[model samples]
Target: MLLLSRPMAPSNVVLLLIGLHGTGKSTFAKAATGQDVKVNPTGGVDAYTKECNKYTVDFKQRRFIIIDTPGMADQNTIEENLDVLQQVADQLQNLDQERVNGVIYFHSIEGARLSGVDRDNIRILKKICGDEFFPRVAFVTTRWDRIRRSEWDPILVPRNRDLETERMKLLPNGPSIFRFLNDGESHKAVLDYFAGLEDGTAANRGDKKARRSGTG
Candidate 1:
């Protein structure tokens, strides 16, 4: 597994977690990196918000920087929100391109129902990052513990349909989609996904490459 074999500490790679407030971005980050994780909430960016929080974890000799930005939807203009995302992009760009890795986009499983605000925020993110950014994006639907199977099935059915429709329209050949339970079994899937990335597992490598190459 990726987590098991990960370098004692990995350096030069950073993972940014993005999502709305109450979506569990911080929680997931903590789970992924453990304690000692740095969290700098948005502060000094504007009067409305503070600077964003950045946490670092050392694993397998590599230092993984995790950045958490405030929910953009709650902010005023699309431009202002984009500015925050841009700052993140700039920071990532400054890193060694080859070493800089991925982004985990979090969404509450209980809140997966698409909303106008979500659509707008997603559009803004895609616009700023471009289509190639798809490979680096991972959608994390959290709060599984709060949902029952009966409630989940029905909700996810339509939600997945809407997501597929939107992806087909906006990102026909986008990033890989892996579901995380956000509960008891959360670590398994998430760890596997991260491991796949680290070891370049055949399935993950092939699938992501195909998507990036526009052949999938």
Candidate 2:
């Protein structure tokens, strides 16, 4: 239903996904869009590592233009991170009528603690999305299925809270944090979370390349 790929009209909502490489952004895109929507890495099926891909969601009375962007390396890829953010910004700027409705920044929960690299990545992301766009941004913790329920109960939940705390330090305006399983329900949850909110716009017009010294 979101097939009006040429240019978004006033009724459309442009959604964006941004995160570090291998954090399961593409995987979530494929699972969430289903077989009907075309997932990128356009060869045959489910190939990751493309620059950018677009998918659509047709709900009861709403349409969404989901932009899946390539993952950025938080370690030593300052230029690459800048390029990817620019790519997303360019696509968002193309919307003449609509504006960025929401953003999902993924964080894999495989690690036990947030490192300096993680801090750097979130800084760059904040820079890209601007300072006041937190209400529209959701920090989604991905790879939940990979963690054991027992471990989650004893370890993961606490760690997630700690991450949230640290996240607030960097992104004081960052919106709520949620866990994602990449399932049908999780997809709906993501949509519903944003659907409840008005289409909030993000002001990211300048060329604010995150500095290499965004080090933790």
lDDT of 2 by residue, 1-216 (tens): 012122245555567787777677776777766744333333222336555567877753567778787766656466656666776666545543224666777788886666556667667766655776666676777777666667766787777778777667776765546666654566555665565554443222100111111101
lDDT of 2 at 171: 66
For residues 1-216, what per-residue lDDT tens digits would candidate 1 score against the true structure? Answer: 001122334533456677666566766666666765333333122322233566666554445666655655554466666676766555544542212355666666555465555666678756656676555556665565455667655676456445555645654544444445544345334434444556565243222332232212
- For all candidates in order, the CA lDDT equals 0.53, 0.60
Q: How far is candidate 1 from the true structure (C-alpha RMSD, Å)?
A: 8.4
